[model samples]
Target chain A: MPAEPPVLEPQFATAEQQRSASVLGMWVFLATEVLLFGGIITAFLATRVFYPHEFERAAGRLNVLIGGINTVVLLASGLGMALAVHAAQKGQRWATLTWLGLTALLGLGFLGLKGYEYFADWRDGLVPRTDGFDPGDVTPGRLTLFMLFYFVLTGLHAVHLSVGLGLVSWLAVRVMRGELPRAGATVAEVVGLYWHFVDVVWIILLPVLYLSGHHEAADLHF
Target chain B: MTERTVSPVATVLTFAALVVLSLTTVGLSFLRMGPAGHLAVGLSIGALKAGLVALVFMHLVRSPGRTWLAAGLGLAWLSILVVLTLSDYLTRHVLPS
Candidate 1:
């Protein structure tokens, strides 16, 4: 007798059903992710409202150049990720794979650059001034608090980026195996949605954390 | 991924242009902007870039009207969350000056 064919598990009844479910599930998941970051933003806003001077003084010590570049990198990655989904949904397999690969490559590039920037921060003595750091940029005491927020927000975003890359890698494997179907491209679509949401978070974060204040510096670092 | 709304080349090129836009936006941040001005412009550019990406790349433009509605609802609710929480922060009294 012939061997059994692989059992294809039907997550939903039809392509339309899958698409609808995927979109709905992604939207709900995004709601939760929004609240997660929402809490962080709320805390930041509260701190800023109460201690505008202190926050500004602290923000000034951050590397605006790195933050700005990161914003562009993430935004571009979002675009690429969206395009990947677009290509996939339309059954343009080659374009889909190309865009997907580009997206993943860009994601990895961002992580690499982020690592380098983080190292630079440590070298600059930005590891919480309360931990006996003195970067000679701001009041050591307040600077410590500022770095604390900086690490918290961007660090979390970085963690999200890693998770996103992992997701993309898994999706890529499916694509390679032809398991990621063109007709039912819900998984790719939803993953792209998650990716775009993360990018939006970074867009808001860069300005708030890096460029929130401006007092003319004697020497522009970037 | 709706090909009907846009072409492959169009999507890729638009993304390229947006990449350029993002670079310019970041570059502008180095110019002197008071705190609020800096955030306002930078975030505006970010929002625009995001919108373009969504419209062209995410098939939001070509998606059925109802899908767009679902998306709008999602974002609206998200904005509500931000605004409501922010109201408290903005209106709070008795904090260090």
Candidate 2:
């Protein structure tokens, strides 16, 4: 007697139907995520319109070098994730594991760099609402507002990145255990899409966070 | 597992372009553009890089209509919110005339 083939659910008559539905579901979820981040950004932009100079000055005080490096790191992680998706589709288990592992490592590298920058900012008195927060030629209140936006935006992004790291790590383990490929490529594809969307958010955040006030670094440390 | 679809070489190239664009945005920021102009340039570059990543790395370019519709609807909703909110805020007088 031959082993039984994997059973498809009644709702999804074909494997392709199941895969399309899964992908569509993930996209819908990501769309919601866009609005979640979008609301914060909209608030920031409104604040910017009112306090352009203060915002720019406060922006300059951030560590652009570290931020820039983190951008590269995240982009690298995206590349690894894209490759992992390709490998998963090809049914190369070991290759999928390798790429996913690399993606997670890069994600960790991003978080590490981001953590270091945050610590440096805190020590430098850059945190809004904290004492000794001084940005030259800009009112403390305005500067504080800018810092508030900065922290909130980047903090939210960090949270998302941490989640991506966990997801990628989980995917790697599953691939190692020979679980995912058997389940079909939908899981890998949707996971890849989520990872890339995170990367896109950072790509937008990089400029809004780092570049907006970078030109006028009146008192930058680095 | 299934057959490979996206080309690895193309993905790598897209990554390279994104990195280069990032560096360029940083470098451009060092020059004096007014606040609005600076933001415009930086964001435009960022958007371009994002387009590459989305279309290539995310496989949106080859995705089915269902996926595209989902993604488009999200972006459209976001745009509506941003534009309308900004319009109202930008037009209001924050100070006494």
Candidate 3:
């Protein structure tokens, strides 16, 4: 096979230089994303520290089965994305498309499960800031605060995942059309970085939101 | 680029590790640790999982120094925010409502 033409831009000295620059730029953007979610999480932690029991009680009401399933789904999606990038780097167009498709499907699966979880939360009256707000046995004020954090965190994450779905789909289309040549694999790599970062956020959230309160409820039960 | 690309075997192994760690987090949650203990352990495991994802799947292990700097800067700033904020809340006595 002939050497794939390099996709070097005007300013970049070489293809490798361009790839590094793109990766670095993505990292900087991801750094800002870290601060965005990090700030919210800090606020949640500060509140939890003050009202640990309340937070625990509120957290116990969360659907752990759904959360765990979503964790696996998102992680699988991340793996697919990594494989997609790997295939792209090797100039395997069909493999790249296949992995990207799988990644998007898994992402959609995560969102579908999340939507179901949200529906369950609504039916349980766990959602706050609305007319149907109910805190069950926990203090209304604290449960409301916890639910707010839960919604905001998960909702923001869902939005990001939706955007990721769009990006992955777009890339898949390009790959199918032969527009994204092997040299342009850096595009897939950068998108993979974002996908993995979102996965990282969900991983942190699993414990912070789901696992923190389960032991208390278990203690009461058994 | 070939050198930079993570082998399929390594990627699969990282995925398996993440799955096991996630299950462990769930399993640990069944133990009767108090709120503080639960939070500590949960977040600790979470941090570990996050580190794995960052180092391997995110390519930080093979990333350039500048990329590592960017990642480190994010964590450093997050620490500053959390520590400063917690210092105030954790030190204050909760007035009984």
- Distance (Å) between predicted and true CA of A206, model 3? 0.8
Instruction: Output the number of the lDDT-best candidate.
Output: 3
Give the candidate number with the greatest DockQ: 3
lDDT digits (tens) for residues B1-97 of candidate 3: 4367778899999999999989888778778788788778989988998898888888888777898899999999999999999988887875433
The fnat score for candidate 3 comes to 0.80
Q: State which candidate, 1 or 3, has the greater TM-score.
A: 3
For model 2, how does the per-residue alpha-carbon lDDT over B1-97 read when each residue is reduced to its tens digit? Answer: 3433679999999999999999999888889877777788888999899889888998888887777899899989999999999988888886545
lDDT of 3 by residue, A1-222 (tens): 344577668999988888888899999999999999999999999999878988888777788778888899999999999999988887888899999999999999999999988988888787875445555665687878998999999999999999999989888876776745555588899999999999999998988898888643333210
Model 1, A1-222: lDDT tens per residue? 122233334865565665666676775677677778877876776667766766666666677666666666776787678778766666556677788888888888888878887887887777776764643554567667777888898889989988998888878776666644443356688888788778877867776777676634442454
For candidate 3, what is the TM-score?
Answer: 0.92
> How large is the interface RMSD of each prediction?
3.2, 1.9, 1.7
**Model 2 CA deviation exceeding 4 Å by range:** A1-7, A216-222, B1-4, B93-97
Fnat values, candidates in order:
0.38, 0.82, 0.80
* Cα lDDT computed for each candidate against the true fold: 0.71, 0.83, 0.86
What count of clashes does model 2 give?
Answer: 0
At residue A32, give the lDDT of candidate 3.
Answer: 94
Candidate closer to the true structure by DockQ (higher is better), 1 or 3: 3
Looking at candidate 2 chain A, the ten consecutive residues that score lowest on lDDT are: A1-10
Indicate the worst ten consecutive residues by lDDT in candidate 3 chain B: B88-97
